[model samples]
Target chain A: MSDLLTIENLKTYFFKKKKVIPAVDGVDLKIKKGETIALVGESGCGKSLTSLSIMRLVPKPGGEIVEGKVNLDGVDLTKLTENEMCKVRGRDVSMIFQEPMTSLNPVLTIGEQLIEVIINHQKVSRPKAREKSIELLKIVGFSRAEEIMKDFPHRLSGGMRQRVMIAIALSCNPKLLIADEPTTALDVTIQAQILELMKGLTKEFDTSILLITHDLGVVSELAERVVVMYGGQVVEEAPIDSILNNPYHPYTDGLIQSVPSLTGEIKELHTIKGNVPSPDQFPKGCRFAPRCHKAFDRCFNEHPDLKAISDSCSVRCFLYEDKQEEEEYNV
Target chain B: MSKVLEKEILEKESAGEPKQEILRVTDLKKYFPIKSGVLQKTVGHIKAVDGISFSINKGETLGIVGESGCGKSTAGRTIIRLEEPTEGKILFKGKDISHMKEKELRKQVRREIQMIFQDPYASLNPRKTLGSTIVEPLNEYNLYGNQKQRLERVGELLETVGLDSSYSNRYPHEFSGGQRQRIGIARTLALDPEVIIADEAVSALDVSIQAQVINLMQRLQEEFELTYMFISHDLSVVRHISDKVAVMYLGKIMEIADKNSLYEEPMHPYTQALLSAVPVPKKHGATQRERITLKGDIPNPANPPKGCVFCTRCPAAMDICREVQPILKTKKENHSVACHLFE
Candidate 1:
């Protein structure tokens, strides 16, 4: 399959008074048709900002995408005019936010929300749009579809609201769907249902997903590939199995180790010392060098670029840099 | 107040005898009234917590794992007397403190039971320095007399929670989320409380910071011989920190067992589904359990099911499950479950 969306060296920054903070410093990503890729990171790591950049929806008054290309189906989104980007947003790329409650308009009924998206994107009659809204609700797993359409967002549960959100996002059959922490606000059982629904819908509609979340378990269960970000930069990108089993980046390894195992003997959890640095206070060299346990003298003075160690795996750490070079020389 | 209890538990553990009970709650019920219209006449009750029973041994941790609105937080609050119980008994060291007057309770029981809230930012007073916040409890109880001693005690408590003693002078806004949580822990410890009710304490932290705080809590438990009622919605965390685990749904415990039996071979249909619902990070194509996806959302708590609260969504629900509420009964050695299948 050919690539559906490709991001190259994308940089998003926030201007505060005189200083510029690089919230998303140079991120590169790709998703093939029907592929589901997860962008995993903590709160301030710029995973959400990267997704926003792709939608041409980075917040204004301070934030802007300053560099690189977000090419979707041979079109660079950053170069598009405001009016053109608005048209491309719902028809070609749709997004679901973390809090479904806040993302939805409270006053509007579920049917109105779904119908507006359909009418905005496709040339359909009012009656036809309403029909499509009910059908979309059924596809997202609502038994009483008509009753749900009449219900307000507050009347529905968090999981139900999220399903409605997904219904609207997929109503246009966008090529790429950006879901930022889609299941984080729900219960585990409900989260399981949402994950299953997303997995099935993406496969059935042939929609590519850029799932952004901090939960590794959600990433492990649904995504085919995983991209780990830290301090506004990509630290590792690999097949889900490699990232989980044989992770090359120290930060990735620490994250995997930090999660309490469900099936093992209870031992003291491994912790990465210190906290995630704020964007304004990021280190001069490697952003992770301050808290990394395996840091050496050189790691403190130089920042490492993401280097591919194998055909399918890449890492950003001084420890992996020498190993990759030695392998290339031997080859 | 807590030192005497600590010595007793240490003696019991050293002698290899059954552990002493620190806190016990029986048939605890808390209901908030719902009213309508301008007159605001009481119509019905939202049964936040309805008749739950559990006990914690001294120096042990009881993990209460459930979904939101399952009454886990309410149970924690009621036990701490933050919310008055509608009915039932709360026993602290075999003494009923459920109906004690507020003044008497504060003088006797409040110092022994402290709570750690989830949102470290909202829970802390932003305008106050860390020193004053930690020392407020000490001043309330009039401990470590004299201003100099209280200030010194604040520094000592900060260092005990893996923070620098010098940080006592800094404000809450000056610290990170993880550091603010440590400050909360230090404040909780200032009272030398025997039983700490942590309501979703580490749920708001990042993964790495969560590990650090969990490790800190475990170490503090060892040092102070503290008993904890760790209530959270995260099962993996509960499995890691709890010696005993209770799975709750619609304000009732479906199963209660040691961590091993509960995680390895869950008995109740609700417990089975809940454990399977947790997304375990696994290698691709790894062997995993067949997930039991529940049918619908939890029913309205005000109008719970006539029988088992879980029967609406339970996969293995039978006819009897819809008519008769299953009482929690011993199913195996050291394990109890509330379900009709075993009956």
Candidate 2:
């Protein structure tokens, strides 16, 4: 599979009150064609910022992509003009936000929203766009597509609103879909439906997905690859099975152990000590060392760079230092 | 609601077992009236909690698991009398206090039952110091002795929840989400309440922080011999902390059983579907779990299905399920399911 979107040394910084906060510092990611990669982290870990930076939608005045190349196909997005980037956004790649309620406009009907996106990217007649809108609604699992088109966003449930968001994102038939906490606000049953729908739609449309979530369960269900982020850096990246079963990073291990399982005997849950530090207050050394149980003297003073342990696995920790390769793995 | 069930519980308690019922709720219902038009006349009632019954033994956690608007929160509030129950009996230590006067409640039931709110940020006063916020409860009940003793008690309470006693002087804004929640727990514990009704207590926290708080709660439950009515939408966390679990939908419990029975062999179709829908992060081949996707959203609580509340989306809903409401009945030892299929 060819790489659809590649981000190299991505750093999104927030300049607040004359202080530069490294919100997303030095992230490297590659999404293969028709593949799904999950960016997993706690709050303030810059997972959302990474996705925002990719779409060039990081809130301005304070936030900016300080450095990096967001290469989609052959074009470097960072070098593109504002006008050029606007055209590239919905046509080449689209995004789905966490809260479907706020993301959608209440005044507009579902049909209006869907058609607007379709006509915005593709030069199509209103009637044709409306026809395509209903089709998109049907594709997202709406049985009464015609009625739903006329209904406002407020009339639908959380699950239905998310489906509408998915429909609009897919209306352009973009090569890649970036869903940021797509099902976080939904109930588990609704989340399951959405996940199932996304899986089916991915296979059908052959669209690669950059799924941003704090949920390991959601990642296990949809993503083939997992990128574990902590304090604005990719601490670990590996295949889903390896990440779940045998994580290289101590943070990853602690995270997997923390979540109480549905099937297992009720045991005392393992906890990563302390809270996730604010982006500005992030430690100078390895970001996770403060909370890490296995931190050593070296882990407290020096930052460990992301080093590949194998062809498919990479980790950022002094514990895995002996196994790390001298050369970086090629995407 | 059955005499037989009450007798069985009492008989078990008398027959050498020390399982004394701390709280028992029978046919609890809370209806919020919806009035419209110029006259503001009585129009309809949003049946937020409609006839839910359960009992919690002394020092055991009874977890109430349900989706939003399923009346789980309302049920908890009504039990604690935060919200007045429209119709039902709330028995604390085998005495019905559902219609008790506010003054009497403060003197009797209020001191024994405390509630920990979900949003740690909204629940506490931003302007107040952590000491004052916790000590306010002590002041209300006229607990401890002088100002010095109260402040000392406040410091002790903070230390109990794993926060430094020195943090009592700090404001709520100075603490993180987890730290703020610990403060909230401290406030709840200041009264030395026997039953703590925690509503979505850990839902707002990150996974790691959530585990820390959960562990803290467990340790406190043991230390204080505290009975908990832990209400949350998160099934896994509920299963982990609860001795018995109740699954609610559309203002009624679909199933109530031991965590093992409910999680492993859920009798109600709704319970089964809800469990299956939860995505588990397990090793490959460890989970070949069949997901039961329920159709449509929860029916409007104001006008829930005339038949079964869950009939609208129940995957295995029968013809009878559409015409008649299923009453909750014990189908097995210590397991109760409210589905017609069990009959």
Candidate 3:
């Protein structure tokens, strides 16, 4: 499969008068066509910045994508002009924010918002746009798409508003959807409904998804592959199952055990010691070494590059750095 | 009022129910008035906590789980008299304290019942040091020793909540999310509250830190013999923390059962959908994880479905479920469900 979205050595930094905060430091990720990739970490780990950088929507004045290239379907989004990027935003790549109720314009009706996006992207008449909006809402599993379109955002329930958001995002038929904690604000039951709806609709449209969330359980449910980010960098990247059951990076392993699950027999949860360091205070060597249980002498003094363990999996840890040790551990 | 914990009381019939039921809520209701026009006349009310009844046995955690606007938080607040109930009775240790005057509540119910809020940073006093924050509560109750002794007690409380006694000197901003949460727990523990109402206490922390706090909470519960009303929307967390779980919707409980029975054999359709909705860490079947994803959002609490609060979204919702409201009735030995399907 061709790469739908490719991010190379992406470095986004927040500039202050005296110091520069490298929120997303030397990150790399790739999402293939029709694949779902989950980027996960604790707060301040820079997962959000990576998504913002891809969309060329990083907040201005302080934050900027200092170094890196983001290519979506052979087109470098980083090289696109401001005006041209506007055209591509909804037509080629769309984003669904964490909170739908707030993200949706409170002043506008659901139909008006949906119609505006559809007409702006597609060469459709006003009536045609309205019809397309209704169709999009139906695809998102809305029972009364017609009624929902006439209603204002506040009139609908949280789940309904989220579905409407998805409907608007899908109106343009974008190849890739960037969903940042789409269901975080909804209930578990509603979350499941939304997740299932997104999965089915995206599959129908053959659109790849870049899912950014904190919940390990949600990541396990939706994403085909996983990229474990820490200190604004990708620590490990692998297929979802491989990352879940046998993560090589100590951070990923600790993270998996950290999430209390239903299946595990373990009594006490294994805690990763210490909080994620702020961008400015990140450790000198391996950023995770300060809190890593398996940190060795070299781990404290030097950083390890992301190394491939298998054809599709990789880890950034010195424990997997030595060729002989890597083979032994792999065996 | 409450047919609550009768089974648990009977099970411990020989040992004579260790630690007589600390808190019992019988048919509690808390409604926020919605006024309209310049007159500010009563238009309608958002039935935030519509008639709900449950009890917490001494030395046990009773988790109330639900989605947002489901009244889980409202239930917790109402129980502690933070948001006074519009109707129903609150019996803490078999005494009706539901309608107690604010002054009387402060004197009697206040010290015994303490709350741990969701946002640790917001809950803590930014202007106050960790020592003073915890000590402030102690000072209010005229707790243990004098000036020097209070400082010593503050240090002890800090240690009990798994923070270094030295952290008492640090400000709230200096501590991480987990540490701040620890400080909040320390404040909750400082009063020697027999029952702690933790409202989404660990929901804000990262998974690893959340685990640490949970473990700390479980440890503290055993040490202090604390009865917890753990409120959260996270199913997995509640499953791990609670001894008996009450699933609430639109301010009314859908089901209540012992942890094992509820997780293993969920009887209510709402419960069934809820359990299946929780995504497993590893794919057990991988391909065939049958999820009962409910349709639509939770109905408006102000104008809830006439029959059942959950009737609007229930998959197996019948005509009766749309007409006659079903009250919670016993199903199995220790399980109860409020659903027409159960009937």
- Top candidate, metric TM-score: 1
TM-score of candidate 1 chain B vs. the reference: 0.95
Docking class of 2: medium
lDDT of 1 by residue, B33-111 (tens): 9999999999999999999999999999999999989999999999989899999999997789999999999999999
TM-score of chain B of each: 0.95, 0.95, 0.94
Residues B1-343, model 3: lDDT tens digits:
2456775675567367455677888889999999999999999999999888888888899999988999999898888888879999999877799889999988988999999999988998898899988899878878787878999999998888777898888899998899999999888888888999999999988898999999999998888889999999888888888889999988899899998899888998888888899877774354455789787677778888898878788888888988999999999987999988867
Ranking by TM-score: 1, 2, 3
**Compared with the true structure, what per-residue lDDT tens digits does model 1 show for residues A1-331?**
9999999999999999999999999999999999999999888999999999998888998999999999999999999999999999889999999998898999999999999999988999999999999999999899999999999999999999999999999999999999999999999999999999999977798999999999999998889999999999999999999999998888999999999987787679999999999999998778999999899988889999998898888888889877898879988
Which TM-score value belongs to model 3? Answer: 0.94
Fill in the DockQ of model 1. Answer: 0.79
DockQ of 2: 0.78
Model 3, position A156: C-alpha lDDT score: 84
Look at candidate 3 and tell me the lDDT of residue B311.
78
The lDDT per prediction is: 0.93, 0.93, 0.88
* Candidate 3 Cα outliers beyond 4 Å, as residue runs: A263-266, A323-331, B1-15, B283-288
Cα error, residue A272 of model 2, in Å, equals 0.6
